[model samples]
Target: MKRAITGLLNRLRFKQKLFLSYLVVIIIPILVLGVYAYNQSKEMLRIQGIQGIVKNVDTISGSIDGSVERYNHAVQSIVLNKTFQKIVTNDYSDLVNLSYDLQEYLTPYFNMMVMLDQEIDDVKFYTQTYVPEYGDSVQSADRVKDEDWYQSALKGKGSQWFSDNGLIVVAAFPRFFSDKATNLVYMRINEASMFKNVAALAKDGTVAITNDRGDVIYSNQGATGERLEAGQLQGMKEGAIRIGGIESYLVKKTVKQTGWTIYFIVPAKELSRNAGSIINATLIVIAGCIVIVLIMIWMFSKTMIRRIYALNSVMKRVEIGDLSIRIRSESKDEIGELTNRFGSMLARLNDLIDELFRNKIVQKEAEFKALQWQMNPHFLYNTLSFINWKALRSDDADISRVVTTLSKFYRTGLNRGNNMIPVRDELEHVKSYIEIIQTMKDHSFDVEYDIDEAVFGHTTINFILQPLAENAIMHGIARKESGRGLLRISAKLSNGKVVFQVQDNGIGMPLETANTLLQNDSSGYGMKNVNERLRLKYSSDYSFTVESAVDRGTQMSIVIPAYLQS
Candidate 1:
């Protein structure tokens, strides 16, 4: 019964795996993208909130400035009036009369001042001393000198405003008379009523004011007398600041006469509350998505685990030497492709395994036949040496010298069965080969060497240079219409390694062909053997580079191990 169940599982295939892969690939990316979008949207909303606060604060600053200008003009008019000055210079009987007459004359101005304060709410004046019937109370002359507004007004010939303070009169004082004998004038303001319009305009009703020295003069919510630290005040003219875990916008304007700074402050949260909705919505959507995704993951995992168990059962059948088990899938996807390819590969593997089992004797017979047909080069070398001896006996020195060079070339190439030798030995072998070629071609090549002596003994693969030299001469220079060529071989130490280069002044290869020679094995002629040897010795760090341009020339470089054989 277990074997029957196992056989049924083995027949199950690609559709299930493909569906799970699709879930992972598509659904996972969607979840990731949703999270990224959520974060980005939240940040954007935050920035927008800050900007809105700044904008609102800027508008409030302009309005405050306008109010300051109007208030300053009214004060200046009262101070510069010639009639009022005359009243100040007179004695009691005359001063009293003048005060009443001046009051009647200034009725229109007083009414206009009252109307202005109706929008802004409060204005008050304090004198140093009391006068009978000036109002209900006596503002003593001694108190004038100690008052900031009184002293500041007296010192100045023109009008000025001071930073907001908490001692606001809360009622409109328009143009009040100070009956003090002293020349000082004191003033007060009701900030809430004065900045009422500004508060009404607030999206979240956040605004405040500070003095030039960064003292909190007024806040919209009646918060007062707060002081900013010196470090916070430094280099701050007007901008934004983070306070009490919230960002606030600040704008400053100088009171022309008092030299006091007026600052408008608004909290970022209040100004950007509109944009806050966007953030909340984004977070909710992301959270919803996460919950949905978690549910999906749970479902997908359960289904995938079942499918994997089924596939594992089929795999065990094959592991136990059952080759007939096959995969079946209903969906077309990565899993389907994998199952189809695996089935095809199994068929091919079975064919190859059968072929090998049946032809073992034939393969051995072919190998022996190939070995029997091969000839050793030593026999040819001995025959050539015999000819050289005969030529030397006949007084043919040129023939004898060529034979000797050829013998030396073959001996060095064998190198006591070593696959690697010093670079110097390789160069000598190349030189000997070049000598023989020069003799045959009547010295049709100018070979230049720029080898570094310090790297002469570094080991390189045997016959690394000879084949390249032969190719440059035979297929390259010899094929050109001009029967002359320039072969330049350069080797140097660079960046802790030796770089070897061979450049020929022959017809260059096309860019495409040159690229193929370096990148593809099939396009490399003698290069295939060199590449295989290099791979056997080192890793991908070792390289062969070829640079060529049609009708220009070609340069080939080899980067090998720079160490001496230890």
Candidate 2:
């Protein structure tokens, strides 16, 4: 059976195999487990919903109780003030004294109480004593004698909180005077400030504060005029119940300061919304897991196949004489190890090629030396000196100078068959070549030298500068349309390296031509030859760079490590 199953899988395409395996390994087991988890999570969510509602109701109860206590204390403070009590109970004999005393003392005290608490709208004293009403701060008791809140204040001994149309009214009866007067201290508090927290907690629900008589005193739903049914109030003791034809969650807590119950009612659908969201999230996560698994399977197969194809490509390149190709793989698997071995083989082949190339260079140099030795150096110098003497005798200064400069140029360039020469000697050789060219051209161009004295002690490959200077004169300076070109040769030592530059202000070549100048060996005894000689003598770090523009100029730079002659 195992062999049959393996054969069936091998015959399927890669994507088909992935989908079939995923259906068996992940989809089947997850569907079964997801059903079981949903059943368990539904029950847990309902219980936690009730607990959360209860805690929220308790918090609202605490906040309402704190507001009530604060207002009660404020009322009590005014009632106990002896000066206030005297002002309320005193009977005026002279009308002028009464007006003066009310303006100077009582008016300022009432204004201060209203200023201290931003929630306090007004502070008034109601009394049957014969005192003039002063700007709504004092009023006659006859106006509210029949009111229920006033009656409750008259009957109560301490401060009592009363709600009238969502407004908070606190009244306190003072007993500090012996006149036995029906005097009440009344304070009105802003209702919105008192119930702001309840409004915040009742987003999708209704919150109400109901008195013992089941009358809604303050409701965030604007149902302050409604009264809770006796049956609904009784059913609240037993958890959630039907309220107004909807099955709802009821959480109620009694405000300890006033004996008022705060009721929080949320419909069943609203409470179960979170559980529905959690179920939808679980389904999405399962679907996402299946998608991610499919993607991972595709990527795994593609990666293996891609590496194999890359190895094949590398082998094809090696067949076409391209041994510089490299494969950078960190994997330790069989394919990765194969790639590593291939790279090692390419490296060995490159080393062998370099060895053969160096041997060829040595053979060519030996042939050049043999050709040089065939000529007698003393005889050549003597013949050049003899021609110089004849030109001088004939009174031809230009010919004599040219011959002398030619002799000096050859002497410096030969250097007794040594391949390396001092930087000073190389500079002198190029100077002689420049002098010969200037004499030949009738001094059409200017020459400038910016050689640093520090480079005089260092040595470099011979004939590196002469070929560059010759190219500058032949290709750059000689083609200037301005008829007077400037040739600047500069050498400097920087950061343990020596840099030499040959620049000319002439009709320059295009960037494409400058780029290919040193890339091939077709230009014999030119820029290519100079670059090859430098590469063979020094490390590969040595480089040549060329810059040119049509109207601007051409500048060629050579950079090599500074080496002192031993």
Candidate 3:
């Protein structure tokens, strides 16, 4: 079961989980509360029904007691009257007439008793001699007349005016009317009237009275008469019995005066009918709430799921080499922020890739240039060799001197095809090229060198100085006045850099052309190639600079970072 539940949960969507959470957290609680409310309502209704019955029984008993007291007062007034004594002791002739007048005077009292009994569904009587004329027609015995109550009524006993019943089902009050002689009156009451009164108060149920022998004395609406057997009556006297399946409440009270029991039966069904309505209403509300919660859960889950899918898609594309793909999310939440940052990272990655490609191309071009510079000097050596061989066969002395200078120039410049050599070797190559030029052309040019001997063995590209020297002597000197020019070559240590300068007093170039040659903005093959080689050897720190003004002279500086002779 546990594994099955785990699998079910794993297969369910986020929305399903959200809905289930609502069921556990909200809907279930609502159902529990509904059940709680139902039980509370049932209990409250039962309590209300019981309280109503108790109140009705208490009110009826009070009214009956009040009526009995009023009758006692009337009888006391008649007993203290002196006129009533003379009628009993001396007026034997008018005795029947006096009794008739007394009955007539007490007509309103009898009518009052009838009205009270009718409204409460009970009966009442005030009797002295079981008088049929006085309307007291209850069962009585000759022995009952001589009972303690009868004697007490004949002459008021113990200053006792009245007594209250401690139990239900029976009640009685004895009243005496004496004439200061042997004349007296007595009254008694029982459970019959009390039972009838209890019945009047009952609705939707029953009420009854039972004697000490457990016999049913009275009942209302035939309900109590049919259900109350002798044994049931005894049980009522002891305590109320709640019958099963009858949705009812029962209360019992025993009358102290007559040992009779009063039983009240009330149906719980009638009082608790509203409980069903409350439960139905509660269920309707809970169901509505569950629906609302489910809708909210679905919407939230969809929103969350969609964002996660979008992020996953972005990652998949990135994994497949689509580095340019980006997530476009406008929400200012955590997921949105994460996507935005990821997009930015991808953008940076694409930029870095492009930069790396460009760098690779630049490196390949530089390698090609280094290879070209390696081959150029070998070609020049072959040309100079042919020139020297021709001059030797002709036996020309000046040409021989020129050929020898030229031979030494090419040999030193090539340095046996080695690209790097000592700084002094390169300078000597420059001097040999100058000697060749002086022999073949003219000695009108003045040459000077200002170099530090300590830096003579430092390594440099073998033919770099010679090219500048040749350019100055040929193009620079050929345009000079009188065919004479000042040539200055200098190399020294300056601020951890090898500072080398070659200046010629000859026709100078325009600013634009001078900048183009030095900065190498235009690729005039020889100058651009030389500049590129320098860059390949020493990066941006080592390069050429040219300063020139027309007819003023041209000066060039090649700066190389200083390093040891090795």
TM per candidate: 0.46, 0.60, 0.35
Candidate 1 vs candidate 2: the lDDT winner is 2
The per-residue C-alpha lDDT of model 3 at residue 259 equals 49
The lDDT-based order of candidates, best leading, equals 2, 3, 1
The residue pairs found clashing in candidate 3 are 167-254, 167-255, 167-256, 168-254, 168-255, 247-268
Would you give me the overall lDDT of model 2?
0.80
Ranking by TM-score: 2, 1, 3
The lDDT per prediction is 0.62, 0.80, 0.63
**Candidate 2, 319: how far from true, in Å?**
13
**Candidate 1: minimum summed lDDT over ten consecutive residues — where?**
167-176
Question: How many residue pairs collide in each prediction?
Answer: 7, 0, 6
Scored against the true structure, residue 436 in model 1 reaches a CA lDDT of 86
Better of 2 and 3 by lDDT: 2
On TM-score, the stronger of 1 and 2 is 2
Off by over 4 Å in 3: 1-394, 520-525
In candidate 1, what are the lDDT values of residues 1-566, reduced to their tens digit?
Answer: 99997786567554445555555666676677667866777668767766765566667666667766666666556656665444333434656575675467544455566676664343323433333323312234454456565455455444545553442211112233643344323335566666666666553644445555456555554122244444554466565676555666666555443344544555654544677676577567767766675667667766666555666676787789887766776658666666666777767877887788558545633543343234355785798789899999999998898888877776666565566788877877887887889778888788888989977868786776776777677766776676568888888878767788888878888888888764455433366556655665676878887888866778888888698855
The C-alpha stretches of model 2 lying farther than 4 A from their native spots are 1-27, 87-351, 360-376, 389-396, 494-496, 521-523, 538-540, 564-566
Model 1 residue 327 distance off true place after TM-score fit, in angstroms: 16
Among all windows of 10 consecutive residues in model 2, the one with the lowest summed lDDT is 222-231
